[model samples]
Target: MKLNKAFTLIFLSFYSFSKLLAQTDETYLFPINPGNKNYLAGTMGELRSSHFHAGIDIKTGGQEGLPVYATKRGYISRIKVSTSGYGNALYMLHPDGNTSVYAHLREFSDEIAKYVRAAQYENKTYEIELFPDPYEFAFQRGDVIAKSGNTGGSTGPHLHFEIRDEQQRVLNPLHYGFDEIKDNIAPIAQRLAVRPININSRVENRFDRKDYYLSRYGVNYAINDTITAFGKIGIELLGHDKLDGAANQNGISTIEVFVNDEKYHSQIIDVMSFSLMRDIIVHYPYDIKVNKGRTYHNLYVDNGNRLNFYESKANNGYLNIEADSTYHIEIKMYDPYGNISTVTLNIKGKAPAKQIKERIDFELDRISYQVEKNILKVFTRENCEEDANKELSIYINDSIKTVLPAYFLNNVAVYLWDLHEGIPTSVLSCNKGVNISINARAIPHQATVINAENFIVNFPQSALYDTIYVSTAYEVRTQDSLEVFSIEPVTVPLKSSFYVSASPQFSHYQKDKTHVYQTDDAGNFSFVGGSWSGETIQFNHRSMGEFTLVTDDTPPVIRPATEKNYYYISDNLSGIASYTASLNGEWIMMRYEPKLRLVWIEWPEGMQNKRGNFELKVKDNAGNETIYTTKL
Candidate 1:
């Protein structure tokens, strides 16, 4: 069975490699800048917040409504209109077993726009996904299909384009021949980090990671400072790439590391599967990215990172250093167009230190903690002989307590506890206790629960991308009887949504008007409709952050803006849920942009002059309703 499994794996690997080779040979024009008149804003396989950028972003001169063209002759397969994420997008199926996507469109072409508008009226919703017949909207190659816009989650005016296979695996658009996009600039290796993998391992005589600056020599670079390393170590680099005629930096395609002339590690991000996109959290150092805002690609494979974009030898590129031994390292960063930048380093391994002396300085009011992978690390000041035997009292919510001994570190006694067992609400030691801290340790592919006095969090078995310490607390209650709940470490991404069941502490006078909402940093409330089962209210939350229960007594505001062509409809809380507009008691087609809080009518060709008793009714998420009636 083992041999057969290995054979299957090898065959699949070869088939995938051959499929990629064939994909590159296929031809597609650039979606924007067909004549090479513009530069790209993003590259395929770039690391983006929450997920990998599935495609390329074509710059539109920082303006919207630019004509976007079809790269190849294909038929419309899908169309999506929404208030978020790829607003007004189109998908086409070509003859080459590939699907082309154009997103953030200002408007579709004449015929396509008409079809989409009709669909919206038929469904009576601004957000809709529709599938058209295979040849319903076929067009020739290089034909103008839509106009680009800075809609949805886009920060600026650009067209987000993508090429994917029938299986939905995203392919690099740069692979296809596109003379429009040019790149000759090599990637820049900004900084290098060497990490000690084991307790006894040290880099520069410290158990923590040490970062080095790079000295440039032409297109190549080198680390000028002499480095000392001991025991097992892993490497990471912070680097970026640039294209010709553009100074904006994006993701690099590949990085190859060699130890003394032998290939040890290679990371290539040519293709990424959407099913495994969230694995990005494990691809880089999660703690560093969240706390330091720096993305450093690991030169070594990490735990639970199943991204099929790496190749390495011997323990996934972790170099085990011995006392008095010397090692040479070479790192090469490559762009998709074959431009390369190199960096070199030399390390001398010194004898490992035993019983190292260090001063301790810190308050034990709150235990300092950093969760690296699944291990729960707590830092505390180390004092006298009794401090060496101090153990952390893990206070589980169910009254069970587990004590873990103090581990090693120079200035602090680090308590390294494996969180696979469970998570604790608080950890206590010597007279000091961490309150309302790590609620429970959530492991990927396993269900976990965090029970508290005010609420209980239920994590689905597939809730996590990687093992993380789930933190939750009832931050505070407002005067309006609103309870703000913090379920945090908002930086980590989840594979599945978690369920929150909470008991209400505030007055329930307006029980029927109450619902949960996710609050952003800007104080905007996104209604996450929840249901109450007696005393406990339950809701599904997609992301980790602040959640609150709001009683929205105020109805949606609907006021005339432009006589009859437009209306300003907004809700103070628990945002607008449903709306309807009528001309003389007859339904009319109305278009809306939620982000702008504007609603208007695109009157049918002949209905502009005929207007009577105009009425518009809008409702908020908590069932509050408002109506505006006027005559034209």
Candidate 2:
């Protein structure tokens, strides 16, 4: 039996590779319509908040229930259903050692749907993941597999599709033979930015970087003038792509930078691994933090970025210009269809300008902290030109903890503390009330606990990626009837989710209506559900920010958008969680678009003109439910 199993595995691997070669020779059909027009809403390697988008988003004409077909002969390998992220997703493992994913689906085909429903009932949960045997389900190319819909984290109706190799690396779907889809439009360059990378460097006689709006000139964009710079400098481009008929702006496919007509850096978005997705932030970290709705590509690669998309970087794409000279810079942007756009600029290298150091005033609001390795690095905007050689005191629990000498890097004052020494208790404060309370074990590899008057925080050894000093505090807003707990600062990124248990002052009657919420920098609260245990509420969060206990008693409101049947649904406090609509006693399919706050059901075929009693039920995250009944 063991010998037979090994022989079977070898045969399957060989068969899969053979199928892969055949498909590469243009034997497979498009996953959707083969002859109809198809547009892409997003592309592989698109930069997202913390990760790169690993697949393509195919437009579904802003509607749901579009038939999704199998791209090749494959077996149903995996199926996942969830309320968030890729709801109702299906994965197919082809004989070619590749897997095709269909996400945000409305429903599967009849046979697959039956299987899924039975599994859901057996598991007794709406969210589920299942892996079926290879012989359980199989399909040929062009077989209808599922129907696309707007589900999960989707902002609109589109099909999120992916093609992955046997090792699970996502490959650009466009690389496959989808020759019928047409895109002749080129990417557009909007702006260019130049930054002084070194402390001795200056851009246009200023220490800070400058952004220049680019205007179209013939086939290329130009800054229209030369930029004066000294020492090492880096560049950034703001650009996006557009398909022939789609109005949605998509990510560019490739970028190449040249200096003096020589290739300095290039990035081709054809493949990506799941582990390298987080490096999207490092590629354009500043832009990712500040820009919303725009795509910014950094011409330079950071020293720590490990993404494989970048290639042939000369000094990581930074131009070192110490002497008087002139250098020509050119950038080429491309779309998946081979359409290209070019931009050109000139950098005039000159002598460094006179340096006049100014003293920086340390403000309480400007102080922040970062954790790198085992060092707790404190950053302040205040220039410490004179204080660089001076020692500053760090207080823990209102007592003098230790004194560390300040250091200056690029005009900013920074202080570093080694966590291997010891972990402080209660509060960590420097001068001017810049303090935060932290649990000792909050840093990874360390064990610590924190107990305050109203909250208790427990940190596991794996909760952090590095050693960090954490600060927390509690506040009561009597006027707003809120109990706020300042967890950790937002600048610190958490590697693993942490637990927080807080005892907020609330009445027993508010138990069902009360839940924990995370607040943004603007003081706006978003629901973060918690479990109530006696008087304490416990929750786990992946981000550091302010949290509060909020009571939401109002039920969700459902308003009819169309006089015939459509309804506009909304919630005043906690967002909508679950909704259902039924005719008589049978449940009917209701298409919900949370972004548009619209919900409606298609008139059932053969019963389009039938009139009956309709009941709609909507529930919020806080357990508030509202029901509406009316004659259709």
Best by TM-score: 1
Report the C-alpha lDDT of model 2 over 1-632, residue by residue, as the tens digit: 45688678767856765765567443556767677878888887777777778778998888999999998887889999765789889999886778999999988998888787667545544567999866477888899999998887888888999999988999988877687577888888889988776545677755556789997975589887988898888898988888777877778879999888999999998888887776675577343354354447888886456788788756887889766798889999987778999999999997754432544344435466644333555655554456544444565544665544344544555565555555443223334335434445355666557786689877677565544556678887777767788766454445557788898766643888888889866768799899999988999887767898778999999888855789989998789998887787666656666667877774444556767889989999999999988898
Candidate 1 C-alpha lDDT tens digits along 452-473: 6699998999787767777777
lDDT agreement of model 2 with the native: 0.75
Candidate 2 global TM-score? 0.71
The TM-score of predicted model 1 comes to 0.83
Model 1 residue runs over 4 Å out of place are: 1-26, 196-202, 209-211, 229-233, 347-373, 376-441, 469-492, 518-528, 559-564
Off by over 4 Å in 2: 1-26, 196-201, 230-233, 286-288, 291-294, 303-306, 312-326, 349-481, 487-513, 521-523, 531-538, 553-571, 576-620, 623-632
lDDT of 1 at 439: 66
Query: Candidate 1, residue 172: CA error in Å?
Result: 1.2
Q: What is the lDDT of residue 375 in candidate 2?
A: 50
